[model samples]
Target chain A: MAALSPGNQGVRLAVRYLVLILIALIFIFPLLFMLMNSLKPTEQLLADTSSLRAFLPVGDLSLDNYVDAFKRAPVGTFVFNSVLVTGVTVIASLFICSLAAFSFVFLDWVGRGILLSIILATLIIPFETIAIPLLLIVSKLPWFGLNGLEIGWLNTYRVQIIPWIADGLTIFLFVQYFKDLPSELVEAARVEGASWWQVYRRVIMPLSGPVLATGAILKFLVMYNQYLWPLIVVQEESYRPVMVGLGYFFQLNVAWGEVMAYLSLITLPVLAFYLALQRAFIASIASTGVKG
Target chain B: MARVSLKGVRKSFGTADVIKGVDIEIEDGEFVVFVGPSGCGKSTLLRMIAGLEDITDGTLEIGGRVVNDVAPKDRGIAMVFQTYAIFPHMTVRENVAFGLTIKGVPKAEKAEKVAAAARILQMEHLLDRRPSQLSGGQRQRVAIGRAIVRDPAVFLFDEPLSNLDAALRMDMRLEIGKLHQQLGATMIYVTHDQVEAMTLADKIVVLKDGKVMQAGSPMDLYHHPANLFVAGFLGAPSMNFISVDTRSVDNGLAMVANAALDPIEVATTGRDIRTGSRAILGVRPQYLVPSATPAEGMLHGKVTLTERLGAETVVEVGLNDGSRVIAAFGEDRILAPGTEIGLAFDPRQAHLFAEGDRP
Candidate 1:
């Protein structure tokens, strides 16, 4: 801090450091306020709501906000619902996308050019265009899907997962990932007399973990953040995921403070999942090397 | 281990025909090299025989049975690709065992076969390494080991050494020649390098534009090339072709005049030639000599460029009529640029092609 005139320079340096500290505090202050308020008694929280002067409400830094959050909006059930639905969908998307990618990249199936074109065409078709019809179809009975046979999507897990599977984004990710894989590897497997499944299972799958994890993580984030679709069909509060239930929870309880607690709860898992999957994504992109 | 035959086989990618009616008969345990310039369908023909490509027409037989519709795995053939198509994900051991494993061979036999093939290819120390971890030569060795473990009736190699450095290429070339002899398996090797074709093959199948130009012993093709393409394709610093009028010499030998020289008597018993017919005289650089005395085979030309290959020097000479010719010399021989080199040819080794065709 010492420079020119020691006293004045020290004062100037302190001011510069204070400005940087103030900027940092401005960003972190709101989160600190929320966390502290979440711990405060309602009476004190409302009295000085703008300040961050409160300590833990209970002697042992009370977990009352968490307990209240679970009771008020079915947090446990909502989280479980999210993990199950999104987890299964991620797994299924990875499987289906990997299979499609395997087929597109390696096998000499006829009309692959046309098939690839159709799949690529899906990429530009936004999910919003299909959302209403998809929800309507999911709300109703299914029919003539294959060989004129009837299928149903009414209030079923299919209502969420099927539409998500048909999402072009996932397939595009897989196809792009698979397209760069070495064709020589597949040719080698073929020369070794491996059936297509063996090639996909033994070679492609083991090698595709990074992209698969990335694709799965992406799907999980989308399905986790999803509110509109779940809001329309998931009438059962227990069946509702955290995002949709967060909306309904606000309308019913009006617990702004507790919802912040809920927001914190919902937000951390998504961040953790993203962090976990990001490593895989980075690894996948690295190993794929350069793509033509 | 067995004979292979490709009869009237044709392949067309859409309307553009790549292989136009090729027929090649490979005898039991013979190493046949397919040599051609790029886009000449040599690799495509090898792929056809390997069952990697559809025949489109006619039949491919391996071990004496048609394999037109047979699966590549079931075709009694194994192929080593130019890229050394070893599975990057698998260790050398696994790559070698993959064929046996796919055939549902017992784990014990798979291990035994893989080990034996590894030993044969001298890749036992690298059994645990993936293809990416190995050098280009090692990867190619593993690829050949993979083929060997199959104990296939025929082995197909598609430019397997094109990726290696020159030193490694020479090493692998000798290794492959030894492999052919040791395995006693019918091998159809495709390479654009005629030296590989000459050194490794019992019979060399020269191809061009999807058709077989000629198939014969390398020496036979060298001494008596069937056509211009065969003569041009068979050698490095390739054979030189100088056009000349053919005339019957005294002792019933057809002598081709070197314009500058008196005459070169070519040894051929044929009397079917019509007089005054034009022919292209073909002679290799190694056979051309810088004559000591002015006489019979002396063809004078000025040296244009000289390339020394340690043991030998190759001199490209421009003739008086502006046509160029090449002469190969031992290191002791010296020629400077613009110096007139009195070149002579061995008449016995001299060849004549009628107009566009070599007889």
Candidate 2:
């Protein structure tokens, strides 16, 4: 291929940038529409839906919809519950799944291959198939709380966090990444007088940032968007997550602006979590070919 | 700094028996090279001595203490892997200091030891760079630096230079030889390359099928190999074996007859050979030469292939009995393929193996 002339190169660059901007707009326009409509009144929001002004903050802008969204539901408690549940679940899942994967990959034990296959076989079974039985099992599970020896686990934070802590996909992702690491490094550390725990803490874990970020992002998204399980198990409004609390804005005369405002609020945590680990997430995807 | 001894050491996995009854004594401060073909249990034997592999039925002693139950880190030895095992996430300085740091060495002492090792490896300037930024040779040096900093009793290298290119392998080989000389440490090196074993080892151990074929100095093995395997394995363009029949001759010498050449008499040197019994004659390529004068025991063959290296020329000859023998000559000779030539070697340079004996 021959090199293009300077004038042709300029035109080519302009076309490339135009294509990229258009692609970016396709993904971002919905979020932009939500954010702009969140600042508008219901009337203006309904009217602006027909024009480009739906994505622009140009008409009757105010924080009244946000205030209304909070009044219509316990948005503060819902946000707090979602963050706490997602944070605890993600942190705990990373530790548990990575440890499980380490055993499956490095240590030689009898029946490991069969056990790994059985765990991976669970991935093909959809959660909807077992969700009802899971709910019934968790409803009667005993726990020691402030009052001591509670028989039922409904309307509790542990119910939301514990069930999502360990899963097949997260363990599989960690196993793939750990398998790619050179075994010689592990042996070298062993010969360097590091115990297995020291090797895991000092050597393996430091090299595992990409996989951990991948696992955490995936677990965060799954736990944050929890709706069906929480809707069945959590009857009280105080323990409802953001997705289940979204029903409050869908009354007989639906408040469109309040819906958008509540959506924009709930989306902030996911956006912040993803953007925080954006580089590592991309690195993990590029290395493992795993998509979240 | 330490002597390693193995007595009847064996390894078996599910009735396969990878290493069967190996026994050897390595003196203190001696560089020993375990030279063998692949799957010869050389690396497994080394791992058993390093305490990385368990000894199935025998005892392993290092510095006069039985250490069959000891861990690798407690065996007073360090290993450099075939793939340089320096941590990719750590700087060269940090990698060299890892063993000491994990042992809770003082900071000043750790820094001093790492610096000393870096200076010895000539990698002081690249101490701050991670392994990914370094070249293959530099990474290998960092691995050696890691081993040196521990100041272990014995150093183990598992085909450490096999990953490098030819020129770099030669340079690194010289560097390792120099390191051995300067440190005077007991080192066990393993490789499938005979050139490396012949060049670097004070004592060479040849293994095959999980058994020691021979063990001696490099020249001792080159001059007098115990069996056919050692004779063929120790040299490039390996020693040629020709089937011959032995007969009684004058002065108690054995007369050898073969289809490839005329009958020749050789001194048996107290070997048990009966008349009319079959034997094998072993001769190296360097000993065989293209001769013009008609002589006794001269073989006639056609030159099938010729490799003209600048310093010497090697030619493969095909005999009437469908056997091939390679002969090396000093002067450059342009011999075309299918050119008939007379090849001859001194009787004293020939080796005889009994027909029943195997490697």
Candidate 3:
């Protein structure tokens, strides 16, 4: 093999990095546009929409649109509701899905194969097909909470949190990861006198860092971006998640600045959550051969 | 130490029976090994004893108690797995102490037990290292240490040294032997390696297709294999079998003749022998000595191949009937291919099996 000269190698490296940077900028363009437009006034925001200047913080910038966005709707409550729902849903979803996957992968129960196939079959059926039936069921569900016997779960935090806790993809991810773990460890744990629960708690769960992160990130994204379900179910202001709350800024000629500000605000939690688990998520993806 | 016994144990997956009907009595403090080829049900039999596999149609007892329904942990046994099932996320100390911790042993006592196991395994300095950080042999020691900390009545090893390289496998083999001596625990080891079985087992159970072919001490199995399968499976170069025509018999001996070899007198051992009946003569490669010239009532063959090692040499001989027999000799002689050599076998050392015989 012939080796390239240092100058030639440097040029090749520069071109590769240039292509990567271009692709990264293409992906980040919308977020930059949102941030930049959120700082501008309404007139300037609309004026810069046609040009590259819209992505840059060039003309008039201030936090006035943020203040106006809060004044327009219960932005604080929407942000709170989305974060609460996503966080609780992520944690609960990870626990429930991973547990189910463990049982599906390890324990030899009757009909396990058919049940796993049924669950995997559900993955192809888009959630949109089941949305109305799921909504109808939750609408008439009864809850015996601090209020002692509520009739309906609609327009409540529990309605949002409960239905999204377990899904097919997250369980599949966990099952895929757990299947590769040596079965001997589980057998050894059993011989060590551990019950199946203890085996899962100590031996399996501790070694499941990457899959847990993968499951959590996926659940967070799914719950955070929930729009149709929350829009139809949650009529009260306090229960509306961020995606549904974005509609508040859409009325009466659409306060474009407030719209930009609300979008930028809602995108923060997703970015932060992803960044926190990006290392483990990437590790899980690499290990499990799963694409993002 | 514990005595484990299985009575007519059978295992089947659906319609396929893996272990037909196995009955074994393992004495206390005796190191027993189940050695067989793949798919021979040795591992399954061990798993049944460990209570990891349910007994399909029999009873299993450990330490005088029928433990067929007992959980693996409650059966008073700890198994070292072939994969060295050390937790990759935990330090060596934590992995070793896992069983005691799960049993809710007090923290101080757990520490003492873990420390003692680590010391015995020579893993004191490696207690803080994760499994990924340790070498293959060290990780296996940690696995053994895990089983030791439990202090169970019986220790089960499932091909625990098969994953290591050749040199490490020998080293680990010696270490496991020493560990068995030091602990004096009743250990049941399963391996496909006959050498491991020969070197470490106080009692060896040879299995073929879920049935115990023969169970005895190493020397007993080696010298007196009951059947053709056991004879072929026990040794490295393997025992050679030559078909002979029994022409006549006299005085408790059969006069056997094969083409290209002289007729010899083989002891019938009181078995029914008729004239013109086919029989097989069995002799180990180590017993087939190479002679300089043709001798009376001897087998002769042309040398087809020769392998020379430092300590010994193995030579393959082609008989006139298109079958080959291997002869192993000490490094005193090296014969080239195509060299004609006469092979002599002591009548007392040779084994003869009638057609369709089991023992």
Candidate 4:
């Protein structure tokens, strides 16, 4: 094969960047429209929906919608609830799921293969099929909290956080990552007098940064975007999450400007979580490709 | 240092038997090597001794105590793996001190031991670097340092140098030899490389198909291989096997003859051999010397190929009976293809195996 000339290389490079820029614009257009129209009045917001001006912020704008968005509903409590549940679930899932994965990959026990197969088989079953039964189970479960021995777990942070702690996807991610690690490290650790717990905490977890970041990002998205489960379980205003709280903007006469403001507000936590873990997530993807 | 013994040790995974019943005795302060081809249960036997694999039958003793059910840590053995198995997240100092840390040793004592091991391996300057920051040879040294810090009763090595390049493998082999001398610990090393086994071990155990073929000093096994398998497995350019028929068995020697040569007396230990039974004669390539004339040589053949390797020349000769034999010469010889050549060897340096005798 012949090498490309300098002029041809320049043309190819420019074309590549042009294609990438077009893709970038396609993804960013919706976010641009949301941010721009959030600053306009409801009349201008609805009128400009069919034109490019809706994404340009050229119409009359003010801080009225932002102020009204907070006053109309308990937006602060909703964002807080979502962040709290998502953060706790992400942390606990990384711990419990990684432990389960560790047991599956390293330790030998009876029925291990069958049990792993059963757990992975859960991935094919959509949550919609089991949501009703899951809601019934969590509603009657007892909790020992500040008001010791609570009879039911409805309208509580634990209700959202505990059930999502050990799921099939997170555990599967950890198992695949753990399987790629060299088994010799575990044997060497054992021969060096390390207990099983020490191997998990010191040796395995330290090497699991990329997988942890990946699992955290995935679980955060799933839990923060939760709507159906929280809608059925938590009817109290104080326990409502961001997705269910979006319903408040859809009353008899919807406020388009205030709705955009609520969406823009709720999208902040997910964006921040992803940006913080972007490097590790990319590293995990690149390494997985290389290993495969 | 401690003595290690295996009494009828065997291993099975499901219905397939990996390691058949075998026995071996290793003395204190001795460097023993288990050398064999792939899938010969060498690594499995080493793991069984380290308590990494469970024994299916029989007993294993370390320091005069049966430790079949003991955990790897409690058995007082440290193993160096083929992959080095150094923790990529930890520095060399931390890796070396891991065992001591698990034991809850005092900080000063742990530091002292780590320093001593680093000094022994000559890696004190690399103590602060992670495994990813070091080369393959350096990572292997860190692994050895980790083992040294434990100061265990025995050291186990599972093909530790197989992952290194040729030059690095030579350098590490010498370093391991020096370490064994410096520490004077009982060690069991496993490798398929016979050069390593011949050079580094005080005793060499050869295995084939999960059974012990022979176990003795390196020179003893080389000179007196019990069967045809050991004869071919031990030497490079291996021993040349030629089929022959025994004419008569007198005293301790057998007179053998083949179509390519006259009757020659070869040494054997079998006492139940018949007078006219088939046998094999084993002779090393180095023992075959060139003769001036075919009439005066014990064997006569035509040179088929020659490999001139600077200091020595190896020649492959085809016998009249449609068989081939290799001969290595000390000095370079100009024996081209299709050249007629004659070779001779001493009877004492040759081995004879009867049709079905075990040694």
Candidate 5:
């Protein structure tokens, strides 16, 4: 190493940079180890756990674990169920939240303050605090138009979509966002002879690019990796999200090699999504802090 | 262009009254100014007319149509705010054409309107740049261009020049005057500067505590002020008031005097003026002149303070009984502090305020 200067300022700067790199490496080592573990053979894993030599096969390698992972579980069926429920919930939640938020903000309804207070009050409550009462409500779906249209949420796909909107956190996020938004922009649009729907579609929605990106990514992650609610509601093998299926996989087949490959497979989509949405994630957190 | 009127308009925030029953009638194509001190409810009244704030009481009529419940866009008025509220994300051309583009105007016609507005404001060179990239004066020009593109019947400016520097403010003032001369749009401007009101307005409205003190032309206000507040507020260095009583001179002629002056002629004959009324004489600083000795309409005093402001001297002359008045002088003034001096007044220019009457 080069000799540090006598003054402590240069030494401090060098030490801080080195510490940051070390912390980053420590945080990232688990993913690297997991990747290496997924590539090793059974014999080599039994031989050594901490050596680089054990990561590759001795003579020839095969994609046997991936094939076995697909055989032991209906991976395609799980992915379809996950994507379908998550897709509907994301679109529905965004539309409902933005509409309600715009109404509470711009329109001078009589009970606007009370409505906002009730929405804000839900933020202090956690979803787990109301899970039992929520499950009771979802088990008996409201009769809107037709008879025998009940959505018995235990072991059903409808269970996932209802809880997504019923969770007050999403509405709270939208309301807080709409409250701080500049009303001058909305007024200008109204002055230009635009209807309320036109204003929301042309002006409010276009201006909410960053918030929507962030909300979509956050909601997708929350619903994609859901386990507790899905476990309580879904009992059938074909109706669960991919995360619940992975947990069921470990219980039925105790083969650690196949399990490791399956878990790694399940993590790829979320990891890719994280990489794609890092910018939106940072903007949402930083800007929402300024909204208040 | 449209004329605007406010009949018995009032606004209150909870228990506090801000605008209390203000009525003003502005003529068509006439430029009027609302001038007052801060916290005088001037800006709030402008917002009520724009329909940005709800009218708590009374009616607001624009071009003879009641618009108290109508939305801001349908009010046929465009406004420029004090903070230069141009959209920071749009180009200068986009900002100018935003109102028409929202109205679904054709692209070719939108371009023509934007081009015409930019041409009038002389801002054609900076159309492609964003507001963040333009200078303060350039941004203000772009703001005025935005108002012009909409072709509003009544243009509302809420202290638009306050954000600019002094030199740019003067330049933009000249441009606005020329624009008014060309367009002849009905405009209502609000400012605390009396100079701006004097220089730009076809009529000036003086507001005090949410009430209109007086409304007239600049020269009418300067020459014939309805009360003491208007007389004191309109001029630089303010008008000076000396409490004097009416008395009989050697002949049957009635003259006015206080303590340090010879009697001055009084031709005022009204029931308000009598022998025992507590009346004060008002005179501007420039009207008082230094006299070599005591002459008709002359007063004697000792110089207390001398303020030389490059062009003229403002001398505070103290009377023998310890009251002082300011006198503006030319470059040749030689009065010094602690020196005796005499001054004369023109009786025709003096204003009288009775004790119990409004100024």
Candidate 6:
């Protein structure tokens, strides 16, 4: 093949960057519109929705909507609840699911293959099909918390966190990633007198940074954006997460600016979590292609 | 160092037998090599000895203790894998110190042992570097270093030098030999390379189809292979096999004749040989020489191809009976294709095996 001329190379590079920039703008336009209009009055926000001005801060702006979004509902409590649930669930799910995946990939026992298949089969079943039964089960589950023995798990953080700790998607992600690792590493560790737990903690987990980041980011998105399960289970305002708390802005008046402010605020945690792990997440995707 | 022994050790995964009843005795501080073709249960037998694979039947004794059910770590063995199996996440020092850390050894003792292993491998300067930063030979050294710190009685090597380049394989092969001498430990090495088995092993075990063909000192197996498989598997160009008919059996020698040659007396140790029975005559390529004149007990053939290596020339000859044989000459010979040649070998150097004597 002949080498490209210097002029052609420059033109090719420019066209590539132009296409990338257009794709970037297509994704960024919605977030820009939300942030720009969050500062505008509700009347101006609604009026500019049809034009590009909605994506720019061209109208009268103030911090009143931010204050009003916080005032109309307990946005602080809701954000705290979502972060707590998402954070705890992400950490616990990574631990439990990775352990389960380690067993599935490395150990040999009867019924393992069938059990894994059954867990993976749940992926095809949407949450709505099991949501009612799950709600009933958690409502009657026993818990001994700071308030002593409780027969029901409703209106508490445990109800949201425990059920999401061991899901098929997270375990499947870990199983596929663990399968790609060198089996010789595991055998070498075993021959060196390492217990199974020590092998998982030291040898396996140290090399699992990419998969851990990938699993954390995925579980964070799923838990943070949860609406129905928590909505049907918890009826208390104090235990309301961000997605359920978004209902407070949809009153009879329906303040669009305040609604945008609430959305923009809630989106921060998700963005921060993704940005912190984007390097490893991108690496995982590049290597494994998002098995989930 | 400790002696290792396998007494009727058999391994079967479900109904398929991988190592079918293998028995071997490895003396203390001896270097024994398990050599065979791929899928011949050489690696499977090594893994069974290492406790990485469970033994389905029979007993394995290490230092006079039956350890059939013992764990790998408790069996007092360390292994260097073909892939090196060095932890990519850890530095050289950390990798060597892993076993010591698992044992909860004192910090000072661990550091001193790591330094000693590093110095032995001449990798003290690379102790802080990760495995990714090192060359293939260096990573293999780190793996050996990790095994060295464990101070086990027996060391297992599963085709460790197969991953190296030709020149590097030779260099590492010498290093492993020197390491065996320095440590004076019982080392059971597995490889399919006959050169490695010949040069490095104090004792060689040849296997085929999950059964041991023969096991003995290298020269013993070379000079007197128990079966045709050992004869063919041990040599470089491999022994040339020609079908022959036995005319008479007297004492321990048999009178054999073929269509390409006159009757020749070849030594046989088989008790089942009978007159008017078929057999195979085996001769090494190095022993066959071109004769100046056609004579009795000489094979008549036409030269088909010649490989002129610098020191020696190898000629492939087609026998008159429509069979092919190779001959390696010490001095280069200018024999072109389609040239008639007469090949002769000493009777004592030829081996005779009864037909259907596989093991």
Candidate 1 docks with a DockQ of 0.56
Residues B1-359, model 1: lDDT tens digits:
88888889999999999999988888999999999999999988988877778889998888878889988888888889998877777888888888888889999888888888888888889999877789999989998998898888888899999999999999999999998878888898999998899999999999889999999999999877888889888887899988776776445566666565566776543433445666677889889878768867678778999887789999999987678988888765567899977887768788766674742
Report the lDDT tens digits of candidate 2 across residue range B1-359: 79999889889988999988888899999999999999999988888887777789888999898999999999999999999999988999989999998999999999999999988899999999999899999999999999999999999999999999999999999999999999999999999998899999999999998888899999999988888899889998899898888866456578997777878887765566668898888889898988889877788889999999978899999987788899988868889999999888898998877765566
Question: Candidate 6's residue-wise lDDT over B51-113, tens digit each?
Answer: 889999999999999999999989999999999998999999999999999989999999999
| Residue B307 shift from truth in candidate 1, angstroms | 2.2
- Candidate 3 achieves a global lDDT of 0.90
Pairs that clash in candidate 5: A191-B73, B227-B359, B228-B359
Tens digits of per-residue lDDT for model 2, A143-177: 99889899988999999989989999999999998
DockQ of 4: 0.92
Highest-scoring model, lDDT? 6
Model 4: lDDT of residue B48: 98
Q: Could you report the DockQ of all the candidates, in the order they appear?
A: 0.56, 0.78, 0.90, 0.92, 0.31, 0.85
Listed per prediction, chain B TM-scores read 0.94, 0.97, 0.97, 0.97, 0.92, 0.98
**Scored by Cα lDDT, where does model 2 land?**
0.91
The lDDT per prediction is 0.80, 0.91, 0.90, 0.92, 0.79, 0.93
Q: Give the TM-score of candidate 1.
A: 0.88
| Chain B fold agreement for model 5, TM-score | 0.92
Candidate 1 per-residue C-alpha lDDT over A1-292 given as tens digits, one digit per residue, 9 for 90 to 100: 5457988889999999999999998886766666766665456666756443643333224567777887787887788788778878888888887788767777778998798789888888876787788777766666565458656555445576766764567777778877777777777788788898998888788877778887877788888888888777777765778888787456754665676677777776777887877888788677667542
Model 2 chain B worst lDDT window (10 residues):
B265-274
Better of 1 and 5 by lDDT: 1
lDDT score, candidate 1, position B221: 91
